[model samples]
Target: MVVRIFGISIVVTVISLVVAYLYGGVEALILCAILGIFEVSLSFDNAVINATVLRRMSEFWQKMFLTIGILIAVFGMRLVFPLAVVWITAGLNPVKALDVALNPPADGGEFFPDGSPSYETALTAAHPQIASFGGMFLMMLFLNFIFSQREITWLSWLERPLGRAGKLDQLAVVVASISLIVAAEFLTDEANRSTVLLAGLLGIVTYIAVDGLGSMFEVDEDDIDEAAASSGGGPSQLAVVTGKAGFFLFLYLEVLDASFSFDGVIGAFAITSDPIIIALGLGFIGAMFVRSITIFLVRKGTLDDYVYLEHGAHWAIGALAVILLVSLKWHVNEIITGLIGVVLIAAAFISSLVRNKRLAPEADAEVEKSTPVS
Candidate 1:
């Protein structure tokens, strides 16, 4: 599985480079590789979380994740989403925006010769908006992690109550909505309040819709474990339910992937505005790494061994949420976001090692007692 995953990553990277070369030649290839590494480093936690969810999914869904899901990730979210945001906020025509993105200014001085805006300039001009999107998006993701970890199942019980209040309690949607309104009041120099509001609404709505779909489609964890135990290394009953279960799992995975990508995608604006470059570079490479990491975790059963890893990732995600919320009121650097996640996960990993070390002696003693002759 590791070898296969590596092969897949190589194939995807080569294909991305080929596609980029056809579009923008050597420059695109170089940009893709660089951004890909940056994205991968920043999103290792994303892979871990993905593995947890993916393991619960059916094999068919896993295949879908690699297929149609990748298209949505690469084209729809990474490419079109950012471009759409720029267009809506900056008031640039979509075609013109694409043109400018494709052909950046010569010296980064002037993007357009006819006094029209350049892609770089447009991207710079849209920094606050992108920041706003990322800030709110990350906050939502962090909140969701907190909600998930708590004993309280908000969706299971409070779903109807929250619905009764005629309001959305999902943190991401709320933050995005509030950010849109705030940006409307203070940052309306570019996009209309409605556009920002629409964007926020879309983020929230997509999350809820996807989440609901996931709930309906998810498999019972107890059932899977029981089947696995009974099968005893043979094909488990999970294989039988793989089709429908896998589809739902795949959908959930994609949604989670999108949530993780939000900050990175918006941050890419800080580097460059070529949608193709952003999509091919970040999208292809990032997704490939995510896939490889997921396979590694699943095969190794790392989650079972390092339970704290998930806890740490969730806490880091929570911190990221707060950072996103604060970003609404201030200028929060993207590097800070990435750093916080790294620190949280690193701490968790170290703690896990410490815990294992402390328990090793007791475990060895118990093993010696069990082996009487030995």
Candidate 2:
């Protein structure tokens, strides 16, 4: 199962490495490898979070995530999305943007000899809007998770209080809205304030629309049992999603992937400005690796095994959202961003180990009592 899941990722990595070496010699190969590592480290938490959602999906949609989802992640988010951003935000046509992306400015830097910004420059220039939108979307996700009254929590003291406050209806939305307002009002300059606000608002709206639709289509437990009874069968353990629910879920995941890549996409330029190379690293290898981890976790029921894993992922997301908002005011290193997530997840894993050890005796007691004598 592991080999089957990683087969595609292995194939993509070899192809991308060959392509990268061909594109810009050994240097390009090295840069591509670095970006792959960078993305994987930064997004390990993404896999944990994705597993929480992906486990509920049916087998068909899981396959969809492996296939069509990869195409979208590779081409749509890694390739066309950047072009679209350059087109809309930079006021360049799609073709013009592609041309600029493909061919650097004559001087071989982020500016033309005539003093106009290069393609990389244009994309980076739109950082405020990108950060605001992606940050707000992720902030809402993190807030929703923290406020959700889940049975399990890693930091019981903090999460318990937050969950209690979550009883206030629409608290996530109200808090997210206020965060967006504060960010736009204080973090952005006058020239970019309205644009930032608009982008941030759109982020919130997009999250609500996608998440709400997915939730609306989800089958209730009682309904699932009733349907099974009508068909003359016992209640199935699995609530396998299909049709509209699956479709919206797939859409929601893609949006989530896009949101996570905002800082990553921008950070790639700091290493290398070649979009082809970025796509080779992020789309081909990095994103593939992340998804592979997600599938492994789902197949293994890792979330159930490690009780606090989901909480750790959500906290990492909250930290990233805060970092993104902070970036609007001051630059934050990509290394710093990635390290924080890695550390949190590692700590969570260790804590889960401790929890298992503590419960081992109790689990043994229960098993011994239930056993029958010969």
Candidate 3:
């Protein structure tokens, strides 16, 4: 399974190298490899969270994720989305933005000869908007997930209280809104303040809207049973309905992917301002590996085995959200961002190992009791 999964990564690496070599010789190839690794490291938690959702999806939907979803991830989020942002924020047409992105000036200057902002410069200027939106969206996701009712918790001390607070309807929204307003008013620059605030508010609205839609469309077990009875459908047919219930989940996953990609797209500029390299390196290679990891986790039931994995992933997400917000005002090293997630995930994994060890005896005893007395 590992070989099967990483086989594609190998292929992607080779293709990326070949393209990079053709683009600018050894230096470009090396940079592309580094960028791919950077993306993978940064997005490990994304893979884990994706697995949690992917496991709930139907086989058809899972296949869609690998096929159709990858295209969206690679092209839509990596290439078009960034271009759209440059278009909207920099006051350039799509053609102009694409041209500037593809051909950044030699001096890495902010402007072209015609006095228009370069694509890289425009993208840098638009950071506040991207950061605010992605940060708030991710913050709400973490807040809502942590605040929701759950039987198992990795961080019981904090998560339990949050879960209790979640009983107050729309508490996540209230918290997110407050956070956004505070960041915009206090932390943001006076010039970009309105854009930041608006983007943040829009992010919150987006989260609420997407979540509400998911809830509205989600299929209940009772509804499935009732439908089966009415239609004289058997267990297999009921299972099919249950599987198809993942339609909303599929949508949620795609939105989640977009949210995560925001950071990756922005961060890619640190390596090279070239949009094509960013798309190929992070979008194609890194994202493909992430998808493979997600599929691996689902097929192996890794979440069930490592119970705290989801908890750790969410905690990492919360940290990343906070970092994204902070980055609007302060420069944060990508290394710091990556390490915090890696450490938290590692701790949660170690804790899971300990928990399983403690639970093993109890499980064995229960199994023995259930067995026939030979």
The lDDT leader among the candidates is: 2
- Segments of candidate 3 deviating more than 4 angstroms: 234-245
Pairwise lDDT winner, candidates 1 and 3: 3
Q: By descending TM-score, how would the candidates be arranged?
A: 2, 3, 1
Model 1, which residues run further than 4 Å from truth?
A: 14-29, 87-94, 105-116, 121-138, 147-205, 221-245, 365-374
lDDT against true structure, model 2: 0.89
The CA lDDT of each predicted structure is 0.68, 0.89, 0.86
lDDT of 2 at 134: 91
Better of 1 and 2 by lDDT: 2
Poorest 10 consecutive residues of model 2 by lDDT? 234-243
Q: Would you list the rank order by lDDT, best first?
A: 2, 3, 1
Which lDDT tens digits does candidate 1 get at residues 41-86? Answer: 6788888788888777656667677678878888877788767765
- Candidate 2: the clashing residue pairs are none
Off by over 4 Å in 2: 113-116, 230-241
| Tens digit per residue, CA lDDT, model 3, 102-181 | 88776778888788888878888888988998899889989989989899999899889989989999898899988998
RMSD (CA, Å), each prediction:
6.6, 2.3, 2.0
Worst 10 residues of 1 by lDDT: 147-156
